[model samples]
Target: MAQITLRYIPFKTDVAFLQIKQTEVSGIPLYIIFFYIHVYSAIFVLLAGFTQFNSYLLKKRPTIHRNIGRLYVFTILFFSAPSGLFIGVFANGGFYSQISFVTLSILWFYFTLKGFTSIKNQNITQHKAFMMRSFALTFSAITLRLWKIILVNLFHPAPMDVYQIIAWLGWLPNLIIIEYYLYKQSKK
Candidate 1:
């Protein structure tokens, strides 16, 4: 993921993913801005979020957990989620994919916010649950691209067509799996 992201470094317009998005880059003035914001801030989210789940770090180094957790929460709230919504509005695959991405941004923001508030209120269980939900959505960035590749290879569908399917498929299943795990954990 970091490798995929690093291709955009120094911020050139005619590069990597931007090569395919020329239409959006030229047409929508804010598209490039939001796209860059989403791309840059997402790396931080992935890094901080990964550390936040380390049991050893959480137990023996709670201060580290809280610090990285703050990075995850604030980055999502201030940068990632908002920029995601902006780009999602003009996403490929038309309204279907647009709606899916937009919904994802909203849920991602809501879950992360709830997680942060839960911890602030000293509700560890709720914090865990909400952060789980938030991270599930965060993982969608990778899953969405993976789904696109798989769909393209298997069905040879148009790029936008595959994107429409993946926009929902990517995050929904992740959230479902996490929810199931959370459910079973609660039962235990």
Candidate 2:
């Protein structure tokens, strides 16, 4: 994640490095602005959210946990998700990839909101379940890159083909895995 963040820092000045479809978005001022918002906020959300599942942090520093949770929720709702939706429309792999990304963005927002409201309603279990779902989407940023690397090296598919697969593969599997984990945990 830190490496990704560093890679993106250069994009602040040189959006040419964003590459292909993303670079195409650079011409549209609004899209470019939203792209930066999406990237930076997503990074922050990912980092802050990583600590959220730590039992030790929750047990020993509840205030820190709550604060980070608030930051994660706020960042995703206000900045990351909306910008992601915008950028997803211009995603690389035509309609299929666009749909995948847009769907992920919508689910990410919905799950986060549900999690927030669940906790507000004092439904801790529901809150945890919804948040697990939300973070699974958040972790898509990482999984996308990992899948891209694997697919590119292993199959050497065309850029669009790889993008198409990773677009759906990224978040969908994460959500499925998290749901399975949550179900098993509930049984316990």
lDDT of each: 0.94, 0.90
Q: Could you tell me which residue pairs clash in candidate 2?
A: none
Clashes of each: 0, 0
Q: Could you tell me the lDDT of residue 118 within candidate 1?
A: 98
Q: Name the weakest run of 10 consecutive residues (lDDT summed) in model 2.
A: 13-22
Q: What TM-score, over all chains together, does every model reach? A: 0.97, 0.93
Task: Give the top-scoring candidate (TM-score).
Answer: 1
Stretches > 4 Å off in candidate 2: 10-17
Candidate 1 ranges beyond 4 A from true positions: none
In angstroms, how far off is 29's CA in candidate 2? 2.4
